[model samples]
Target: MRKVSTWEVLFVPLFFLLILYPILAILGNITLEGMVRTFNDPIFWDAVKNTLVTAFFAALLSVLMALGFAYFYIFHPGTIIYRIADFMNDLPIALPHTVAGLALLLAFGRNMFGFAGPTGLAFTLLAVVLAMFFVSYPLAARTIASSAEEIDREMISVARTLGDSPPQAYRRVVIPLLGEAIFSGFVLGFSRSISEFAAVIMFGGNVPGMTQVLASYVFTKVEEGEVSMAVTASAFCILISLLLVLFLRLEGKLHARSEKSA
Candidate 1:
């Protein structure tokens, strides 16, 4: 067995204290009564539905946009447009989420789209989706771009030599090879979207059965001094996040096995 280093010993306890302990505390606080009450609450169920629906759309949009960006970055790395996009893609990561939400609110709160209704999109479910997408897009874009960078250029060249056009080559060759990366990017975006609070609450508002999601629901409970309910809701969110992580891990192992078999 390898000997544990001093750094490992020093960091391990810190990791447990800072990260693992909080998760344990949340889970530990869950009571059967609270769980039942949370489960039976119609508002909780509505939040679950809203959260799942918005998160799905947000993640899907992020991945679709990321695919286009990744393709450009991989195939046209020398272009100024690619450079601009590359720089802008990381903006979401650097921006404070509340600031991002405020920006979205300013941009979309009014009738920015011209044809939109008087209220535009703010304080609506669509606003929640946009907020989630704004915060999560960077994760999807970076994940896909990094994976695309690892792809063999020779494969594209060979496909081109075989009379495949660039788009055709991308669709037939690159996309098929990026199955794992695409799934990972989607999951990462979904996970980020689901946990978003500041942005979602700012842009979407905390209106139950409409824009309220699990994160905002928990916040609402906390504001109401319903600690038991908040903890229960938090535990539910953790369970969902944990399931997504486990699903990703399982997918990764299966992808590895398939690669080995091939």
Candidate 2:
């Protein structure tokens, strides 16, 4: 094996100390009694269901919107509209979560839409989904757009030459080529959504069995001085995050294999 560089030797442990150590610490705090309590708690299960369902919807919406963004970004790159949208799409990543939550609250709360039945979407499950989507959209859009940029432009040109309209060409050619990217984008968005706390709490409220998700549930536990329950919930979140990381790694390997075969 090649000798490890001095920089790697110095920084590798530092990286683990900064990153992995905290995760390990959280896991270390997990106790059997806490785990049993968390598992037995109906509220915990409700939060789990809410988290998964809202995250799934948020991620699905993010990926769908990202597909449109990627299409415009790849096919109509020079348009002023695309330029404006491209800049705006990254706003979420830079904005503080609290600010994003406040923005969502302002935009959708209190009869902003006439059909929202007077109270509008704020503090509902839909608000949870919207908050998650707001924060996660940038990740999904950027991931899809980056992958779309890598596709051969010639394929699209050939499809157009064969008399396929832009929409049809995108449907038949671009989307098929974007399968892995789309999946990756959705997974990335879902992972981000599941971990969102500040935004969800601000817009959706921390109502147990309603808008409460795992992140907010953990926060609630911490606030109520249930450190053990908080640790258990944090460990559970870490486990879910680990599974998502494994999925991304597996997807990367599969994509690499497919590319090699191609």
Candidate 3:
């Protein structure tokens, strides 16, 4: 065994503390009373329900879109459509949340689509889900595309040659190889949607029993000077994010184990 240098021992801890200590400290300060109060609050329950529902639907939609986009990119890498899709996928990451919200609002707001048309979508729960899906789909699609690029197209072609239909070849040959990455993308999209704030608030309009989510609710509480309530909600978001991250990590480990056994 060699003696560890002071710098080596301190480096990792310093980075973690710098990045995470404030959040941990804030969470630590929330009393059991604050937690219990939040739990019993109807608003809290409503927010929780809306958050979960939006995240679930948004993740599902995002993953589906990601799958289609990734497939197109993989199979038609040189096409103008693929190039355009790649450029659009890079937009969400580069865009400011408020700017994205405004752009979405402008496109979907009432009278823009048509007065008395399907414009109810602009300031409703559906808008929240749509915003979340758009924000997260690019992330999922990019991850899937990157993984798809690494796979051997020859195996898929061989499956096609051996009487496998396109769908069957994809299911048997491609999906299994890309399963871990796909699952990772799904979790990432879900987690990202759950924590969305500015876009969700702008698009969903914070209708308490309808569209209010954890982040927006927390912001509302903070604005009203309900510090404890805001802190409690923030803590809840942190907890959910941590849980999702743990699940994704466990999933990665399981996928690695399965691959090793194979």
Candidate 4:
């Protein structure tokens, strides 16, 4: 029989108490009326819509970029392309994302393009997408790469031996193996996107209608001392993000169970 340790039981619950208590305390400060009012506001609805659109597009773009990166990283190892892909995938994690925002702003600034955005502004949806993509890409790419590492090279060679084209082999043979990991990456990237504030605000300029994502909305509310609005917006964003992360964790458990059964 296995014995339970005192430190293990005590320490685990203590750890959760430390983390979860603060969140619960903050949430308790929000009255039901505050939530109701925030939901009924047109500005809140606009923020929600913008947040969803931006997060969806950001996750989509990140996954697409991650797939291409993982492909080259797996199939074309020990080359310049592979090194660059590897570096790019890890660079964002190693550095502050504000650098990416700064670089984008400089590259696509008003003076460079002499162009205005949708609301006759310098910052646009494109800037938000790029910033979110730059920050969240590592999650998808690294997750996919880890899965790709588990795949056998001989399986790929077998597909080529059967006269499958390179793209066909990737589509049929490689991507199928990468399914759960890719899904996990998408969820993580989405979670990251919805919670992203600093980079988006820095480069995207957070115009209320055009580029104002939920995180930016929440930040603006907080900065303006609109506590009710900030709490409500933050609560909704946290709920959505928690759901995504929960889904990813559940998928991991299911995958583990299946593997154990196998």
Candidate 5:
């Protein structure tokens, strides 16, 4: 283990405090009464449900796609091919989410899809999912790629030598070694989808009871002078995000313990 530096010890806490003060302030403003009242509203339920559903599917799709890209780049026969693939994987990360959403809208918009707009796509949910997926895939691919790079190639070879096929070696040996990375990638991608405001708002049209998500719903509330509701909604979003982070940490600890025992 490395020793903690003085600058790291001091600056890290300050950085977190800067990040957390707003969340704390938002939570502080919300009364329990306000939370209850907000919860009673059907719109609240709709927004929360949409947020979860969209983020879940978006992260699922992103992680699955990332696996193929990462695997190929990590084990490609030629260095140039892997480098090109790696650069392509990272290209989307550099794109602004809002820009990505606009591109999706243009590519799959009313003119293209031959419908009214995002609302009339052959599948209505496609717009939102594409928007979320566009911005999140890079995080997932990068996470898996980083983990794969650290793994000893000989371990994979040993599995192959034990009569495992190439695909079997990956499924049984590679995936288990990269479990933490996959989970972390899922968390990152999920968080990005949850926080997505500009992309979904633009591409999905921010429709109430339809395309509206938690972040957008909170923005709508604030714009409508529903400060109490907005604060409560923001609180819930923050709480859920924190819970997910806690779960990740706990799961990581269990994995560490199991590895130690092994």
Candidate 6:
């Protein structure tokens, strides 16, 4: 028989309560009135719509880019081309979002090739999506690549031997095996894009009714001393993010169980 210390049980819950009580206290204090007003606010809907749009497209683009890089890395691991692609995918992780934003702004801003196109990507919703993609693609790529590593090369070889072309093998074998990882990557990318601050602000210019996302809206509200509104918005964001992360984790677990059963 093992003996337990009296402090262990009390200490664990107490530690968590100490950390979580303040947040719950704040949430409790925020009224439904603030939430209702936040929803009714014109800027709120704009930020919500823009944030969803940006997150969706950025996630889609990041998933595609990650899929491509993952495929190359997995199937062509011995090639110098694959090595270079891996390096490029990994580069963004170390690169600060601000530096990336600055580089993007310089490339697309009015001073340079701004003459090349009448409406450059600079300061547009498109810029927001692209910037989000740039910052998020690496996370997706790494996730997908790790999943790809777990797939059986022998299965792919057998499929190829059975007259499946490369593309066919990928569709039938790789895609099925990678569904969880790809889904995980998309979720991660969307989460990153939604929570992002500096990159989108700098690259997309935080223009209200144009490029302003939820995070920027929160920032604008806080800067303008709209304390209640800002707190409401921040709380809403926190709730949504927590729900999403929980959903993604549940989905991942279910998928893993299904895979195991099969």
C-alpha displacement of 196 in model 2, angstroms?
Answer: 0.9
Q: How does model 6 score by TM-score?
A: 0.87
lDDT of 2 at 13: 99
- Candidate 1 segments whose C-alpha is farther than 4 A from its true place: 1-4
Pairs of residues at least 3 apart in sequence or in different chains that clash in candidate 4: none
**Local distance difference test, per candidate?**
0.92, 0.93, 0.85, 0.82, 0.82, 0.86
Per-residue C-alpha lDDT of model 4 across residues 1-262, encoded as one tens digit per residue: 9898999999989887998876776677787877887888787788788778877889988888888987787677888988987887778787776777777677777656555643232368877877788798888888888888899989999999999887789899999989998888888888888877778887887888778888888888888888887888877877887788788888999999998999
- 83-188: candidate 3 lDDT, tens digit per residue: 8998999999899988888788888887476564566468788889988987999888988888988889899799989999877887788778887778888899
Q: Clashing pairs in model 6?
A: none
TM-score of each: 0.95, 0.95, 0.91, 0.88, 0.86, 0.87
Model 2 over residues 195-235: C-alpha lDDT tens digits? 99989998998999988999999999999999899999999
Q: After superposition, how far is residue 155 of candidate 2 from its true place, in Å?
A: 1.3
Looking at candidate 2, the ten consecutive residues that score lowest on lDDT are: 111-120
Give the per-residue lDDT of model 6 (tens digit) for 25-134: 65776777778878789888898899989988999999998888877876788899888988888777788888888888887776675775654678888889988998
- What is candidate 1's local distance difference test score? 0.92
Deviation of model 6 at 134, angstroms: 1.0
* Candidate 5: residue pairs that collide: none
Which stretches of candidate 5 lie above 4 Å from their native place?
Answer: 1-17, 77-82, 115-123, 160-165
Off by over 4 Å in 6: 1-29, 111-119
lDDT of 1 by residue, 1-44 (tens): 99999999999999999999999999998888888888889999
